[model samples]
Structures are given as structure tokens and as C-alpha cells.
Target: MGRIGKTAAAALLVLALSACTGGTPDPASSPGPTAAPPATGAAPAAATDPAGQVSGEAVSLETGTDVGNGRPASSHDGLMVRRRMVIAVHPTPDADLGALRRQLDRVAAERGVLLSDISPDVLDPVVLEHVVPEVIVALPPEGTHEEADALAGLAFGPVGSFTGVEHVHVGSVLVHDLQFRIGSADPAALAETIASEGILSDALGNYSTSLDGGALTVGYTGPLLSDELVEAVREGMARGAGVGPGEVELAPRSATGEGVDLSAEPEPAETEGAHASGRDDSGH
Candidate 1:
């Protein structure tokens, strides 16, 4: 499938799973199996905040709504499933945190979205440096095209100017099973290989490959990231570096970012045969 097709399929799968599970997956931790709830005619339960306040934010659209036979609800169904998203704001010369929060709150209220949490340090240190003054927003999941459109309007509309937003990301989950570290010995070459190999590039929309603490760290945004893709990246990196597969390790990451653009084509230098000069100068 093409990149857009693959991304759409992954998004559909995530929404389906969300509908079945009754919520979006926790980005911080993996979920364990659970027993089926006892059959009851009771109305679906509403989410409760520890503070006992509704918080007036758009919760998950899928919350408290169930589709029969464990099937996901159709986009036409007006169910709102709460999902997480992160917005990275560029720092301005005279940035005011309070004013920014108020601006964000006003925007959320206008759009009926809940501004769950806002933090400046939620991003990886590497990503944090480039897109400092960031904030993570947890609002309703975009299960339907309408929801997605609303979000795009919010991100790219008026608020875009306020945050000086770098990007908006949805449904980003950090992988824990796969971990890898690049040593000081060859961090640049290794990072270059990982970026150019097409394995990691194919699965991620916006990503950062940088050296942190004398080791290479990679952070990316996308919903399609899977164990299989992780393994493929590991294997490809191993081959490129002439190292054992075990040498590649995945690192723990927190979710962050907004508006994953899967349609973006990788730079020519980051694609296969990028190193080759077009001319066959060698004498035939």
C-alpha cells in the first residue's frame, strides 16, 4: 500500500480497537487482558476526574458508547472518543505562559475540546530543544472525518499563530519492547543510516534523530508504528552498521506532537541510492 493508504489503514485499526476497548490506549504503558463485563442494561458509565469536576473538555467520543458484537462504531455515529495529542509551540521573544494558556483555553472552549494537560517539558530533550515551550493536549479522539477536520481547524486555524506551532500529532504511542543505543564510536553514520534506510522513515511522519548523552536517540510521530516495523528498523540498522541485531535497542519515550503529515516525501538524500552520483563516469 502507499504511504497514505497505510496510514489510513493504521488509523482505522486504532479507532476500531478504541471502540472495542472503550478508550484510547495509554501511551505511557501497555494494557493487559481483561475479563468481559457482566451483561447489564445499566447506562454506560461516565468518566470521573479525581477532582470531581467535568473539566468541560471534550472527552473521548467513544466514551460510554458501545457498538454491538465488539465492532467499532462508524464515523457517522456521533460518539466522541477521547484521544491524546501534543502541540509543540515555538518560543517567542516575549512569551507569556499565562496568556498562552488563556488563549489555548479560549480556543478549546470554542471548539468544544478539552485541554487536558499543558506542559513545557513533555517532549524528548532532543525534540524539546528544537520545539521548546511545548504543551500536550488530551482531547476527543478523531475516529471520524468530521472530528479530524475539527482538530485540523483548531491546530491550523487561529491557534497556529499563538503557539507558533511546529506540528500537531495524534495517536502517538511509544514503543517499549524495542530499544537501541548508538555509541560515540559512530553516532553520525548510524543516525544517517537509520534515517536513510526507509524502514524508520516509512513508518514515522515527523521524527528526530540526534545524539543525546553521547548516544543516538530517535523520536517520531505516527499511529502505524508496530513491533514488526521496529524489528525491520533494527535489522536494517544492524546491517548498515555491520553489527549484531541485538546491538540495536529501543528507548523509552513519552507521547508528543501534532498533525502527522504522512504525505511528506522523504528528502532525496534520505532515500535509497542517495549517495550515488547520476553520472556513470567510469569508462565502459
Candidate 2:
């Protein structure tokens, strides 16, 4: 009613990872509807928040199993205190690739949120099958569930206006990611610490960081990332010489950072080609 449910949002991550065609998306294309599988009481109840928008009940699922070996990782295996989610956008006919990217970039930057723009490329076959996305904003994790939801909602609040790139409501999927503010630490140095301490591995950990100005911007990774692995990395950063509680702060950007021009026709800015803030999933 209000928006898609949280569970459905998480479900979309699984759908995207599995349904990816690894080919470039056709902006004018759309996926044909799949008949909704019959619902059963046995099936999990529909996700309440930002969910139920999807037509059918999801009966079966697959995850970090065939992708790798060893104990399987469960998406709901833990509480999502830290979080990441994907916002899929269905563009209006007038929407151009660059316009969509700028719309999301300006809006997200205004909120100090980093974005990964999967435009003219990714097509989440399972959920947003009606319209091709001009941009999909990958929101990084906020330290707490309430915080994460608040940030996500705020970033997505200006969906169909402001910049004038209207995105018809499609679907938003919450992916797996655990993030912490690693204040003032050199990302490269902390990365080395994570490596030396064995915080990351092909098995379960991750080593991803981003920079804004000269400081390490909060990094995000998930769905495939392990909680234990991410936990170790957070600890490594927080335990540093003067680090304290590693929490997330959804603050706006400083004055030095470029501001978004909300007027429909904004003057040109730097190239966000396919990623906002010159950052992407790799934590550039």
C-alpha cells in the first residue's frame, strides 16, 4: 500500500543475482509477465513493507549454494541491523539515459548517499519486467534498521519529480550489506589491516571501501557477503588507535561538495556515466 515490503525488497536481490543475463539491457525492452504460481498457506506470508507489489507468492528459493561450496549462507540468517537495498526505476518515455542518471545522482548526492547506477545495462527480470530501468540506485547500508529505512526512504522520496525524471513505481529490493563509518582512517591502510588480519576471504569476508575527499567513505557489499566476515572488518576498523563506535551517520554533504540543482533543466555537472559520485559496487 505505502510501498513494497522489506522482505520483497530482499527477495529482489536474490532474483537479480540469479536472473542476470550478463548482457547489456535494452532500454526499450520489457519482460513478459510470468503467471503467478498458486499460493498456499505453506508459502511464506507476503512481505508487508514495500512488498505485496509483486504479483505472485515466492515458493522456492536458491542462494549462495551453487555459486560456491561449504555451508550455505541464509539471507535471513541474521538481523539486518546494517543494510543495503536496490531501488529499481521504470522511466517515462521522455527519460533519456543521462537524465535518469542525473536525476538519481542529484537526489542522492543531496542526501549524502552514494549510488551505483545500473543503467542501459541491468534488467531485474523477476520484479521490474514492465519497463527498462534508466537507473537503479544501490543504497549503502545504514548502521541500524530504522536508520537504514529512514535513509532509504529519504533518498527515494523524490521519485517522480524535482529533477523531472519520473520513475513509475516498480520494485525495490533490499540486498545484503553491513556498513560502518570508518572515520578519518585511510581506506587503503584499513584495507591492508583487513587483509593482514584475514578479515576477508573467498570463503566469507569482503574488502571494499570508498573515498569522498580524502577520507574513507562508508563501503557496502552483500547478499553474497558473510556476516562473520563483515563483522571482523568492522571490528578491525573500530579497534584502530582512536576509533570509537562504528555507527552510520546519514548526514548531508559539506559545502565544498557540488550541490544538486532541483530545477527541471539543470546545468551540466561531472560525468556520472553509469555511477553516481564516481563510485560503484567495487567501492571505488
TM-score list, all predictions = 0.37, 0.32
Which tens-of-lDDT digit does each residue in 1-284 have in candidate 2? 11112222222223222111111223333321121112221322221123324323221211110011121133323333122344544445564757655655665566567776422112232233333455565555332222223333332332222243333222223233333555554766765665565543332233355655445544434433333444544555566424653542322222222222122212222212323221111100
Off by over 4 Å in 2: 1-82, 92-94, 116-125, 131-134, 143-166, 170-172, 178-284
User: Clash totals for all models, in order?
Assistant: 22, 11
lDDT of 1 by residue, 71-109 (tens): 112221111112233433343455565655565566667
Deviation of model 2 at 58, angstroms: 31
| lDDT of residue 113 for candidate 2 | 71
Top-scoring candidate (lDDT) = 1
Q: Which ranges of candidate 1 are over 4 A from the true structure?
A: 1-4, 7-13, 16-180, 254-284
**Candidate 1 lDDT (Cα, whole model)?**
0.37
lDDT of 2: 0.34
